[model samples]
Target: MTMHIDAGPRSSIALTGTEFAELDRLIFEDDDWWAMPSAEQAALRHRFITAAVAHHLEHNAAYRTFAESSGFTLADLGAPGSLVRVPQFPTRMFKRVEVRSVRAADCDVFKSSGTSGTQSMVWRDEPSLERLAGSLRPEGDIWRTLYGDVDLDDDGQMVHLGPNRREADGVWISYIMTLVEMFAATRSYVADGVLRLRDVVRDLEGALADGKFVCVAGPPVFMAELLRHMSDNGVKLSAGDRMAVITGGGWKKNESTKLDPDRLRSLAMDTFGLASAQQVRDVFNQVELNTAFIECEHHRKHVPPWVEVIVRDPRDLSPVPAGQVGLMSYLDPTARSYPCFLLAEDFGSAETDNCPCGRGGTTVHIDRRMRTSSHHGCALRLAETVRTD
Candidate 1:
């Protein structure tokens, strides 16, 4: 595999984790996750109001019916936060309408994974992808700081473990890889890694042996297989090499639906080797976006106020009081080229409540609804995190 190292740092405005934590505190303090001082964020909200009104008037038959019955016009939402009063377009809209603010050529892109013939969710990541992509850079510095700088032979290699070969809307992994490319040569799952799981580990062992050690990311099922393959091959990564096993998506049915970290590690211990797997951390992300909320050692998908989250009733679309599990949505005013505020079918709860993290924000708890079935998969969108850029 071949790659171009991104030098020491990508930008002058780069922030280490601590600096980002401070910035996150400053910018994200109260109810300002999507409320940035930038004119760009405000403009995007205005554009959304206009587009939503137009949709209500023209294409959105369901919205038009709702508006006509309620005496709400397409122009009713000219003010920000007005959409909150109206019933959200049902999560089923994706299966029925091309519910986009702009044309494919005009707006940013996101895609959805096809459930087992039941639901169609938008997995669009193109919008706000740059914001999410930039978020990962600060994390790179976190790695450099937490684990002292590791010397690489320059042309390092990696084995990525997810649905990245084709663009099927796995946005979180896409940004994760983009962040990783800054440090090493990335060997793709489709292009270079083996079609057979064991063979992939053999290739990784070979890369590490050749002094081109790499990083890896994937779902627990696939990653476990590869880790086992590595164990069978008697492989071990060096100190300079890094790997983070991400619990980015929903659980695999007919398998374990539990989220116990110890059980997850125990299942893959013999294969990936627990010591090596310890480096495999969890990154939280949303398939619909570019900015990812990462996980700390506590397994929490931490968020700053820049990425706004809204938990509402799936039946009528009202923001549920904190601590109640509801359908999760996001408002990313930072994304300029596409729709900034997006309502998704993600299931989680919000907490205005305090946290032990020394930050003032909410911690999301995933309820595994999307993976349940098409009907329930349309229930809520659980935001996943970083790796794709």
Candidate 2:
């Protein structure tokens, strides 16, 4: 295997295409990933994370300096419980600066939804983008396994509640949603920033009339809007066991319109005539991270083996006990264009016990996003300590 090193102030030790391919197979293609033993999974993740850290140390000058200041070294990673010492960038930092380990010219920039009036900007090279897509492959596999009866082929249709890829260019959520198009035929109901309720009803009604398996997917807000429209118009589809509703993103955009997960599921069951609560599933992702944690049939979000999630006490950034709500942090090894080890501003807990769904490993529960006032002080402190430029 040949190795190439770039020479510059922002120099990087680039992984070869063959190396990336091997990593992708190990991380994303393994069929028995969720069933792997914890020790074996940890050892595998530690190896990849160590290499990822080394790559970022050579590529991202600011992150290297922060690591050095924190007395973190590659040797330190050899000790037990050393992974938590890995310096983490606050997720909000991406909103304030461009954090990339690869050349800007080689990256495609993506922005967050910016519901808070400020959007995070992330750069992804082709390799990182490929990994992002690969992370979703397990989701499709799990969905197929759970809903084996559903014929999710070219014959089935996916009714996307968001804009098409081109219409939502550079928007991360839309990009992730449109990826489902590759699995089956998809049609978007939103056009020019407006949700076409009539179009959505027509497509869904047509699908039910033909007994075709259909998936309605997008953010929960749009799903809620569709449900309300259907309820107000007294339109209900009896597509029991033939339709699925997949929701992602946030449940609450604001206080007045907060939609509980159970509420959303119930409304979906009534509005679309879904067979069970299992038909209404949710997916989790963020602009700063490359991996996606998808809920299984049991409604538990299973964390993939390639990444490690730590719930940290918001005050001291120390790891909290499992099943305790705190700030969520991740050590994701999928992104070659950037360091994805990040301290997110979301409140969540992790569970390591076996799930009823039979996927044995860690599962995460995303409670809610930390309020701005709650996280701003911590974010500012972290920013002052880590120099990004």
Candidate 3:
């Protein structure tokens, strides 16, 4: 089903696997290599915002009120600065406010685990929600293609950490379940002896014995627990060439744990008998949208033009120079059902300089915006996840 329902208000606004293609082309395209041509890309970004404004005016109660007051209209809004003149409800308000796109019979919701030391609500239309669901397929299929075939059991054997399933019962429940299904599929490989980890290496060893690739992905703190276990057990996995350990969810704060990308890579290579960071890529993404950009070993994330990642000064929302670390603000021109102009809490700088890898365009060097803390002594920076008036 494109949409997954929960008992009540917690149901998800997710799309289906079959619908990912349409959404993919809408927001992201394979041709979006490097940065987008400024003029063309900006035009698309303008269209996305125009669509959201029109949608809000038509269906969203909160936006309708604001639009009416601001004299919002369907004119060619033509410019980025002009688009911002339109109101933006900081995403955080969803968790506390009653704002919605009309009192519909159906709405999708996905609530974060509050793991980021914050609580928030992520909403999406059915089609966008389906695209979010389809994202997992590409994410999983990429791993599967790299490692060979994997297996999974329908039974909930592998534990899903952070929050309970009931927690996924948010308005965007489909996105949450898509996350659940992804976990199930990934863990199935382990259950079927396809991948190994500190908690279930032996089960995954069966896959290794058969020459299949294995993958481990989760928050850093969660995986660190297993890495310590694997280290003590004298099980060195020189498997980086064939195995992958992708850690995301930023650094788990509110807890005194630390996992640096370099250190994490070192441990994976040492314990798992891996090779280089190239085999393990860190992904940058969010719950609101379906785009997932992978970072190169150099820690630079190459973004296509469809995705406009702007590094803004933390003190002021003005743009910052390239190569300088600052707050990450995004504009995804293709996003529908939701506003594409995203003011996120993620901290990182645009990679304005040329890369030895020959890939060019703007990219993010770091994103401490979502991070509560880090081991590196870089001056602390925080962007309001959502600053609602």
Candidate 3 all-Cα RMSD: 8.7
Q: Which tens-of-lDDT digit does each residue in 259-308 have in candidate 1?
A: 45556655554444334444555555544444566554455565544555
Query: Tens digits of per-residue lDDT for model 2 on 45-137?
Result: 777777788888878876787799988888889965678988999987777767778887778988775534367778888878888887777
Return the candidate ranking by TM-score, descending: 2, 3, 1
Estimated TM-score per prediction? 0.62, 0.89, 0.69
The local distance difference test score of each candidate is 0.47, 0.77, 0.50
TM-score of 1: 0.62
Give every collision pair in model 2. none
lDDT of 2: 0.77
Which stretches of model 2 miss by more than 4 angstroms?
1-13, 17-22, 115-117, 138-140, 149-151, 373-389
Best by TM-score: 2
Q: What is the lDDT of residue 40 in candidate 2?
A: 71
**Model 3: CA > 4 A from native:** 1-43, 64-76, 80-87, 102-104, 115-118, 134-185, 188-199, 252-256, 333-337, 352-361, 370-389
Output the lDDT of residue 219, model 3.
46
Highest lDDT among the candidates is held by which one?
Answer: 2
